[model samples]
Target: MIEARQLTKRYGDKTAVDGVDFTVRPGAVTGFLGPNGAGKSTTMRMIIGLDAPTAGTVTVNGRRYAEHSAPLHEVGALLEARSIHPGRSAFDHLMVLAHTHGIGRARVTEVIEMTGLQAVARKRAGAFSLGMGQRLGIAAALLGDPQTIMLDEPVNGLDPEGVLWIRTLLTGLAAEGRTVFVSSHLMSEMALVADHLIVVGRGRVLADTTVQELVLQAGGDTVDVTTDDPAGLRRVLTGPGVEISGRPGSEQLSVTGLPARAIGLAAARHGIALFELTARTVSLEEAFMELTKDSVEYHAANTLVGAA
Candidate 1:
């Protein structure tokens, strides 16, 4: 597990991270989310001891990351920047990291195969494509078989197959009771993999909760109801705090502020024939946008010019 208490960082007169605190537990994937310039990178750097925190403390397991005798075995990290040497081959890169902790060549070979880099193990790191480079980085992360794994944007340049591969890999690691902390801007992917989330904005933690809770907090789950008498059902369902909308002449009604059970019962009382009713849950992306709407550093104009 990874824990940070009042963790902070500053540069000259600017504060990059501000008294942020969160815990990443084992046996589940925890997603790190934030808008641009929200101090996510700074926080991650502090956790791995790449940058010293100006105040407070962070620990991997029960001690600071640097305090472990075999740091790589305690925690494996793949930060945003590529840390490989351009002159080294894929196999050589993993070998170098493995050598630091006295890891054998067999483990190095295992990771190469695990990441599907066996086809290009001997290729120069500089000549590899972005996806291939990412694979190499992951191979290095798994070299030590650390108890905790942290990755930033692991799917940046991956294809659909590679994306699915990484998703399965992360879940499998968590199932083994390893701490998996992943930071990514891909909300759709995070929604699929992460069980918990730590959302940050403006150098502070905006939310630390589960994916389901956050979505419910943004706005209650929406329900889709289809009835033969749309107009009659709309009138019967309309009430205080309840919202109902549907397309003109359409049999479907989009509803909020009430659950499927309540809607169905209400329709039954009114003798309205229901054709379909589905409880549509709010997505992680929607919740993130609502929670971080005010914290976003940049905004794009809605209208675009010179469109084809």
Candidate 2:
């Protein structure tokens, strides 16, 4: 497990991370989410002792990262930036990292195969594509078979099959009771894999909750209804806290603040035959955008001519 208490970092006069407190527990994949410059990278670096925090504390198991004798066995990390020597072969790179931890060739070969790097294992790291580089980095992180795994954008530039491989790998690792903390931009994939989330913005923690809770907190439940009598059904279902919208002269009406069952019943009471009625839950992507809209540090200018 990883724990942070009031963790903070500052550079000159610019505070990169505020007093942030969170814990990443074992047996589940906890996604670390944030906008750009939200101090996610700084927090991860402090957890692994790459950068010293100006205040507060971070611990990897029960002690600071530097206090561990066998750090490789305690935690494995894949950062956003590639860290391997470009001139070295992928196989050679893993071999060297393994040697640092007293690990052997057998384990190196195992991770090589596990990350699907066999074909390019002998190729120079400089020649690998972005996807291949990501695979190699993951292979190195798994080299020690550590108890905790932290990754940033582990599936960047990966093909569909590679993305699936990463999803399965993360799930399998968490199933083995290891702590998996990852930061990613892929909300769809994170929604599918992560059991919990830690959302941050403006150097402060915005939310630390389950994926389901975040979606529900967005406060909108929608039901789509297509019927022969849109006007009649609209009138029948309209009430306090209920909203209905549709394209003018269209048969489909989108309803809010009403359950699908209620809509169906209302249609029946109005003697209106409903063609289609379905509930649509707010997706994780939509919830994230809504929650973080105010904290976005960089805003793009919309200068399109006559855009509505």
Candidate 3:
């Protein structure tokens, strides 16, 4: 597991990361989410000892990364910026890293095969495509078979096949009780993989919760009800936190703050006939936008990138 306590970073007079605290547990995938310039990259750097924390501390597997005798075996990280020699072949790159920790050539070959780099293991890294390069980076991360794995924007240039492969690989790692912390802009994909989330904004931790809870907190769950007597059902269901709104001249009622079952029960009590009742939910992307709207450092004039 990875733990951060009041972690902070400063570069001269500017502060990149505030006093942020969060824990990434084992046996599940924990998603790290933030907008641009939210200090996410800085925080990740501190976790792996790429940068010294200005204050507080971060530890992987119950100890600081530097304190571990075999640091690679304790945690493996793949950041956005690639750390690779362009002239070397994928196989040579992994082999060189393996040699650092006394890892054997067999382990290097295993990661190469695991990352689907077997076909191009002998090819020079400079000649590899973006997706192929990403595969090589992932190969290095898995080289140690570490207990903790952290990745930032891992699917940046991956094709659909590579994307699916990563999804399966992460889940399999978590299934083995390993700590899997992934940061991605693909909310649709993270919704499917992450069991928990740590959302940050403005160099501060905004929320630490599950995917389901985050969605619910974004205006609760919505429901759709198409009834023959919209007015009658509306009269019975509309109360306190319940809301009923629909397009003009439409019989369907768009509901909020109430479960479909509860609405059905209320309608039944009022002897209202319903043709359809369906529960609608907010997506993870929608929730993220709602939670971080005020914390965004930059705004695009021509795009709704956060919402869409």
lDDT of each: 0.93, 0.92, 0.91
- What tens-digit string does per-residue lDDT give for candidate 2 at 209-273? 99988987874688999998899988999899888999989999999889999999878877999
> Which lDDT tens digits does candidate 1 get at residues 55-170?
99999998998899999999999995367888899999888888899999999999999999999999889888899989998888889999999999999789999999999999
Candidates in descending TM-score order: 3, 1, 2
Each candidate: RMSD: 3.6, 3.7, 3.7
Q: Write the per-residue lDDT of candidate 3 for residues 117-214, one digit (tens) a residue.
A: 88999988988888998888888888999999999988878999999999999999999999999999899999999999999999999999999999
Q: Which candidate is the best by lDDT?
A: 1
The positional error of residue 33 in candidate 2, measured at the CA in angstroms, is 1.0
Give residue 240's lDDT in candidate 3 (0 to 100).
Answer: 96
TM-score of each: 0.88, 0.87, 0.89
Q: Give the distance in Å from residue 242's predicted Cα in candidate 1 to where it truly belongs.
A: 7.1
Task: Name the regions of candidate 3 deviating beyond 4 angstroms.
Answer: 224-235, 238-254, 261-265, 268-279, 303-308
Better of 1 and 3 by lDDT: 1
Candidate 2, superposed: residue stretches over 4 Å from native? 224-258, 270-278, 304-308
